[model samples]
Target: GSSGSSGQALASDSEEADEVPEWLREGEFVTVGAHKTGVVRYVGPADFQEGTWVGVELDLPSGKNDGSIGGKQYFRCNPGYGLLVRPSRVRRATSGPSSG
Candidate 1:
């Protein structure tokens, strides 16, 4: 891995990072994939990945990480219950109970 100097155009990149869905905000209820429900915890660029990412605390133990990547913590959640996904893959969960 190449460890370039820090402070390399954060503002400029942030402008593009603004692509995070306007309706997507921390604390919002969202769903990723099918049958996975979680709450939005973090919404912004991640140090380990490019573009805007959504940190979610899943209601079940079915996730990829604990809101961290490459040893960097973005948000906190139980093991296997935290995941970071692209905003495009997230959907605003319905206000009613999920159908079986």
Candidate 2:
């Protein structure tokens, strides 16, 4: 998780959500960057922590330990393949088949 101390949402994200729903729910395709693709696997507060997070299964080896942070499992996946990012870090895809 790149976001530290994230028990709050960015003001910009609420502002952005007004447009087109921001469809950042489970099973949707997202990308932190342009080329990398990831799937939204889990969306909610994790165990022993606060704030909302999104568990994304990244296509590339771009993530940290597999869905477990602080020795707790929020989602399950391969190492370096699971990304627990703030919902703001991911953006819905523009023009591709999304699964949500």
Cα RMSD (angstroms) for every candidate in the order listed:
7.2, 9.4
The residue-by-residue lDDT of candidate 1 on 1-100, one tens digit each, is 9988777665664434346677899999999988899999998888876778899999999998888889989999998999998887899999887588
Superposed on all Cα atoms, model 2 deviates from the true structure by an RMSD in Å of 9.4
Clashes found in each candidate (C-alpha, N, C closer than 3 A): 0, 0
Q: What is the C-alpha lDDT of each candidate?
A: 0.87, 0.76
What TM-score does prediction 2 earn?
0.67
Provide the TM-score for each candidate, comma-separated. Answer: 0.75, 0.67
- The regions of model 2 sitting more than 4 angstroms off are 1-22, 33-35, 47-49, 95-100
- Residues 18-95, candidate 2: write the lDDT tens digits: 222358788898886556678888888877555678889898888887988898887888999998876767788666
